[model samples]
Target: MLDWSKATKYSGILQLYRNLIELRRNKQKNTRGLMGQNIRVFHTNDQTKVIAYHRWMEGGPGDDVIVVANFSTQSFDSYTIGFPNSGTWELRFNSDWKGYCEDFTNKGYSTTAHEGECDGLPCQGNVGLGPYSLIILSQ
Candidate 1:
């Protein structure tokens, strides 16, 4: 039997779900484009177990979003990933944030993207990534 009273105990999980719901609701228009050719797999490295991609609505600046995922069991420091343009890319979400789970390292990162070239993109940024984590960034 399930304990109904205990359901409210997982505030962290609840918050995470709320945030995800908000993200989906706020980006609803742009998200529809994600299903089509608007999605681009920008980089992938099997050795590092990392992949990066871009999603946008009509492929414009404000609607542009970058996602980086680390599927490895190890953490990475200064992990470089490419960006389509040179500008401020805000770190919108980090799955490894301790706020999401107590076991997380809470090894937060810079809120803005760095300038450089990587994975054939005109701009790049280095980020600290935790194991089995996903990060979302946007300009």
Candidate 2:
């Protein structure tokens, strides 16, 4: 068992913070303050993963950020995202691969809720995103 509060752990993301781009067999971890940057990423372990939470780099100037979530769930290529101020956002990427929208209703994301981004958009503090899907938000 490793300590997540002591030091940085690369067990959950593709890029360790923002420096390295690949994960060695035995060594891999990410750090804090790595909330910005655009780079290639590849991280996975069996069926479980560390990238549990989705983020938007907080509130600031819009910089291009690509997050590829390789989890188990349905995804949307088109939807709305509410910014900090109070406006709906547009989707730039979505799941092109199959096997993403399974059990979405069971997970509470029924088609009616996802009816053309008409559903309530997530606030900045609680942004909604897809699983195992690549998301690119640029400005």
- Who wins the TM-score comparison? 1
State in Å the error of residue 40, model 2: 16
TM-score to true structure, per model = 0.81, 0.27
Looking at model 1, report the run of 10 residues with the lowest lDDT sum: 28-37
Q: Candidate 2 lDDT, tens digit per residue, 26-78?
A: 12222111353323332333443313222333433342232334355544343
Predicted model with the maximum lDDT: 1
Report the backbone clash tally of model 2.
10
Report model 1's TM-score to 2 decimal places.
Answer: 0.81
Task: Kindly report which residue pairs in candidate 1 clash with one another.
Answer: none
After best superposition, candidate 1 residue 106: deviation in angstroms? 2.3
Those runs of model 2 whose alpha carbons end farther than 4 Å from true positions after fitting are 1-61, 64-70, 73-85, 97-122, 125-131
Give the RMSD in angstroms, all C-alphas superposed, for model 2: 13.3
